[model samples]
Target: MAKFKIDINANKHFTGELSPVFSVAEARKASQFHKGLQGYEPTPLRDLSSLAEMMGVKGILVKDESYRFGLNAFKMLGGVYAIARLLCEEFGWGIEQFDFDKLKNEVDEKMTFATTTDGNHGRGVAWAAEQLGQNAIVYMPKGAAEQRVKNIRSHGAECIVTDMNYDDTVRMVAEKAQQNDWKIVQDTAWEGYTDIPTWIMQGYSTMAVEAIEQIAEQGLPKPTHVVLQAGVGAMAAGVLGYLAEELGASDLKAIIVEPDQADCIYRSGSSEKGEMINVGGDMATIAVGLACGEPNPLSWDVLRNCSSHFVSVEDKVPALGMRVLGNPLAGDERIVSGESGAIGTGLLAAVHFSDNKAELMQSLNLNEDSVVLLLSTEGETDPVNYRDVVWQGKYSSI
Candidate 1:
């Protein structure tokens, strides 16, 4: 039994007005900015028809971000774009006037870019810094996988494994960056630190743009429900922003999923005015990437207004999702999704297969006619752990 907590956002008051924080035009601009980068390409959108039938949905479309920029994660779209924008500002050049070679040559050696991550985000930051010819310092939470640390270091970043939880590490890195005058390219936002994080969120909108375009090209109908995995709600807000613009807020259901151990978004959505809430302590979940204790305030506004539901699932849920994707039944194609990447599918499975199916399905308004979209945000970023979970069926040990 996968333990889960779900909340229907009673404070979700969408007056049919789009989010003011991000727009479709900004998302398109971000996509254009990404296209100017070296390895810019749209990741594959796979149709998991077999899985959809098994889950009793009309269809399931998954945006496989495992192939994104060889980073095995969608975070590069955000990190790289944020880095470029920061460099453009620092060099006093317009976006089109920006030249990577010139910036690389003129960049100060003492200037170091920094961020805190569970894994993929730090790798994206390190990879972006390497591409831009700048130094990067990445901080990871205490229990971060060794393979992830090595991946970050492979991009020539100074990787530090901090003896803190994910949220504490983020706070530590932010404070140290401020004290040392290093530029912090974080995905999460708080007061007075909203610009870069907003840029990061805007950059993430590129993925949604690509997915929407791909769905159109394939002649498929717009998805009725979008299940997004949330860590501070940046990616979810980005996707929701674009979709809410293209398809009105009432046309689709936007669901946010997070680790039960780090249910900040769930708590916030359940609050009186969707107020920001903090979950303090060591959040131990196999879905390490979503192990954030606090919701990003900038993203909170977008999510509270546009998103319909917030879900928090136990660790076993994602493990089971990984297994399901890895061992596809019959005609279903195999998908290599990591712990964090598979949570959306996991949440779907938990709700659909659990004993409380009727209540859960009715809450999300899911039915056989509903078309569902899931974002598999990463591949097997950690191979050893992936092997254990998928092949060995070792959910508890993880």
Candidate 2:
């Protein structure tokens, strides 16, 4: 059996239905806002040229988001922006008129922000709330890492662990938030709740803005392809939306990847109707960040129209990616990518080394001239798990 499930999005095309929020112009505004934060720096976009040559691609650029806000992940970009936007709305102030310091000084009421997360997003929300002397309540699904819970609580948030899985916990948190009037900073959008998620997605577009700008500065050609990993499609959609608007969809071939266990976006894209798909149960997977089963309805629209292909791969794929990045080729910078962070690299490596590279390469439109872009969305958030994969070779297919 194939270790991968490659699905062509028959509905994929340039629909020109780009949301105003993801316009490159708007994303630049968000990036400017993030720059106004206390400690803001654009993460490094590494040129994995040697790896690209081995894979028979012209060039490969991986945006290492491990350095984002000292958080070891890119989740905070969304959390901080959504939280800031919430405060701006509540105070009747324009975002452009206030910097981080001004916003912090102006907050009179201590507001509570609530959200459900696996690990990264909760810590992000808690960090954002703590920065402005506000409160946060973070709900985590069952089997959430204790280290993750402690990380959130370290930021002064009340971290709650529940017996439910990620998606179920989201529903439960929504009920409690309604009862307590807590502002939900979730990335997944649903009926009657979209503005915060929209803000979060827009915040995520800063990555796209930075990556494209960095490519130009490095004298590299624009990326012909992007390999994005998705959970609820928030991060993937957010980045892809901005790229499509800025680069023009005609030139970029986008691919969305997810773990086989919880590939909601892949399933939805492959489905005939291309509607929202939900996967329920204990979403057991080593790539915990990509184990989400519910597709964000808002992001689903963008992926359906803006992306070229979707692939769901085994845990071994990400395992290989982690090892390759940790042990880089000569003259290339080493990256300590976590399980969720390294999958894009892993998927590319798999396609290169697979026995049927011809078929797989043709399917993905990857070749000697393809300029690929990958986002290493995190670093070693879970040291134990990272060691298990990289040191022990726990899921190495070989």
The residue pairs in collision within model 2 are none
Predicted structure 2, TM vs. truth: 0.96
Clashes of each: 0, 0
Q: Give the Cα lDDT of each candidate.
A: 0.86, 0.88
Cand. 1 TM to true fold? 0.95
- The sequence of per-residue lDDT tens digits that candidate 2 reaches over residues 107-195 is 67788999999999999999998887889999998888778888899999999999999999999999999999898999999899999
For candidate 1, lDDT tens digit of each residue in 1-398?
Answer: 44444444433544445876688988998988888887678999988888889888898998999999999999988898888888778768887666778887776664699999999999999999999888899999898899999999999999999889988888899899999899999999877888889889999998889989999999887899999888888999988898888878888888888888888988888777658899988888888888899888888888888887877777878887898788887987888999999988887877766778878888888999999989999999999999999878877423
- Give the winner by lDDT: 2
* Cα distance off (Å), candidate 1, residue 333: 1.8
Best by TM-score: 2
Question: For model 2, where is the 10-residue window of minimal lDDT?
Answer: 1-10
